[model samples]
Target: MSQGVSPAAARGLKYRALRALFRHFGRMRPAARLRLGRWLGALAYRCVRPRVKVARRNLELCFPQMSEARREALLREHFHALAQSVVDRGVLWYAPPEKVREMVALSGYEHLQRQLDAGQSCILLAPHFIGLDAAASRLTMQCPSGATMYAPQSDPAVDAIVREGRTRFNDVHLVSRRDGVRSLLRHIRAARPIYYLPDMDLGRKGAVFVPFFGVPAATMPSTAQIARTWQLPVLPVLSHWDAATGRYHIEVLPPLEDFPGEQDAEAATARLNALLEQWVLRMPAQYYWVHRRFKTRPAGQPKLY
Candidate 1:
């Protein structure tokens, strides 16, 4: 370490540099950003070997019937989507809200709007797609009041940046997952729509085993519990960055009807996974394949990763 520079100063310098870099990308034109992201993504696919393997394993597990050559082609597409999403966070985080709204095209939002107009509470089934952050921003921009759950980053500067960027517009509440269901419900009472991602493998705690792409995955069961208890509409939100247009396309599908009735959490969670698999099949490359979806297997079962 340099003897003259203080630790605080060093941290501040790095934080400022990160902020500058994000803003620099935010200010770029959409076409230019796509070019830069593709260039960087191509480089990353060649150099970032570990994540490539993780993604490849995920693809293999999910699509065992697919040919190796086809899977390899899909892996490259997934990496490009991932890298583009990482670079595009600048647009979702630092760009002007107006500019973000202009770039994002929302479809099938009438499903949500009708529910909101009818004074009914809604739970948005937003999965871990590449355009997740951008979709969250768009929801906050359009919805008057909303809530979402997240675990704060360990780094204070990074957490602060994320919190500020997401909550920049509207009355969007960021409830910590650590706070439990009470905190979530409290925010739900204060808000109408809750943006929930129930697909992550959050270990076995408070989760049930469900079939995800024909594999058992630890899945969240609370979506059904909350929906059943609160009589909230569970609407699916789909998002992806379109390569043909270099913009994000978001759609709010109609709420699921006659769901979770007289059914256990495991059954409900399986239904959720089925829906996710359908969407993922339609846009296989855009799904977040880098995550260890089958990390938590059933008891006495071998690990998939």
Candidate 2:
């Protein structure tokens, strides 16, 4: 039913091998690993400067109010942060659990616990922030039975590595997008908390176009649909690298219990996107700006990608 090994898959394999090798060697000290991540990220930023430049152009188009100088600064910082994200994988996957926990501080556990105490399973809608997996892994240490979804890597080697990095806790699960819908429903029915990043464009099928930052973008309606059908409380979660604290901080926002109409899909989705924007704006540099958010534009618009 599937063709073997797309180029993305092959590249993913090579990427995984390189990452594993790096993790094996560079995971001794948390501080040193992050410093190394900065250097490696700088190098990556240079190699992909042209692509990054194009992405910056897109950001400029999307955020017209920002000056070119300020936009450029944001782009450069974003790339450096992106690079650091890559190097930190070593620390996330290989470091001992206590050390990993030390590097990530949970600020809003009481909030999450209170939501759970209300007998409603939470759908943690986390964005792709710096050290995201590390934060996910740390969170799992506290909430062991929770599940998360990830896009499968093209390379088997890379998939294996990612799985190892993600499923460090005993009872955590990784559901690929292809098989995620059914799995998510089952998890919800069982009152198991699940995590998903619904920010990216998941193609055009079965999606609802909604306004994101004044632009109509295609959003996966499945999340909202599930929330409406099951009456599950959707919570916005963000894990960011705190330069001042020199550790990751996980922010668990208040639950969206009052999203008004349960049947008005468009308005509900718009509210969710607005909530997402609040978190994204807090650390615009860490958000995945290079993604063509306007790719699946509203009716009559050309594809921005």
Candidate 3:
């Protein structure tokens, strides 16, 4: 009788293949890697029409006043940015720390340091920009100690790689979503800044419908709740790609003042959405448009995606 390899063995083989590919890409010159990424992105834009459609729909929803021609152009640019960021992950995950640091320029770090120096815990409100992973890696170098929650990848091998790559550079704790908010609060209370991404639609649970680009998006109120409950400062951190220089710049804005004081979760969430709109306006193509951000519609409302 012939026996087949187990599922675990098959997964292991796949993980090894992926790891080898990442290592190969990691060794290539940055310029060449980025060029290749752009080519791949262009190819994907043509082949993966569904994602393109989703992106286009998102643009239409967000920018109703903009002409269709302009939106299409932005959509193409967004794909390029998205692909570059994904391909660049090879460098971010496997490259030398010094090299990675060189590729990123950070501003407003003083704001973060001041909070740490004051012995205050704070929240790093990071949005879902294309360069988010790069920015997070860079922040690890400057941050004394930090912790963040991550939604685990379905593939165990991929999940392992992500966890390893994220924690490799800094003293950062990765909390699982299953662990819930309590684990995050425990880390924050220990004076480790929580690098929170509060801009996604994870459904209505622990979220409220707020205006994102004038559309009622299912926005998480956790950021406001966390800050208000713990009296922690909430700082906005945004990352941008400098195409001219082929580098990333992370801007850490100062803490929002007079925030969430006796304010309901919905009110605070709306304020957060307004700030995110400002950031998106500055770099429309850089924001992650492929995600169905408006997927979780209010009760009885038709799906936006």
Give the per-residue lDDT digits (tens) of candidate 1, residues 62-103.
999999999999998888888888777788778987788877
* Clash count, predicted structure 3: 0
Cα deviation at 111, candidate 2, in Å, is 2.4
The number of the candidate with the highest TM-score is 3
Candidate 1, residue 2: the lDDT equals 10
Model 3 lDDT tens row, 1-305 = 01222356346977677767777777888788779778987887898998998899999999999999999989888888888887777777788877787788889999999999988889999999999998888888788678988998897767666776787666788888888888887787789999999888898887799999999999889998899889899999999997666789999999998888777989999998999999999999999999889999999999877
lDDT of 2 at 186: 67
Candidate 2 lDDT over 268-292, as tens digits, reads: 7777788777777888778777666
Q: Indicate the TM-score of model 1.
A: 0.93
Q: On lDDT, who's better, 1 or 2?
A: 1
Best by lDDT: 3
For model 1, name the residue pairs that clash: none
The CA-based lDDT of model 2 is what?
A: 0.71
Better of 2 and 3 by TM-score: 3
For model 1, the superposed segments whose C-alpha errors exceed 4 Å read 1-11
Kindly give the number of clashing pairs for every candidate: 0, 1, 0
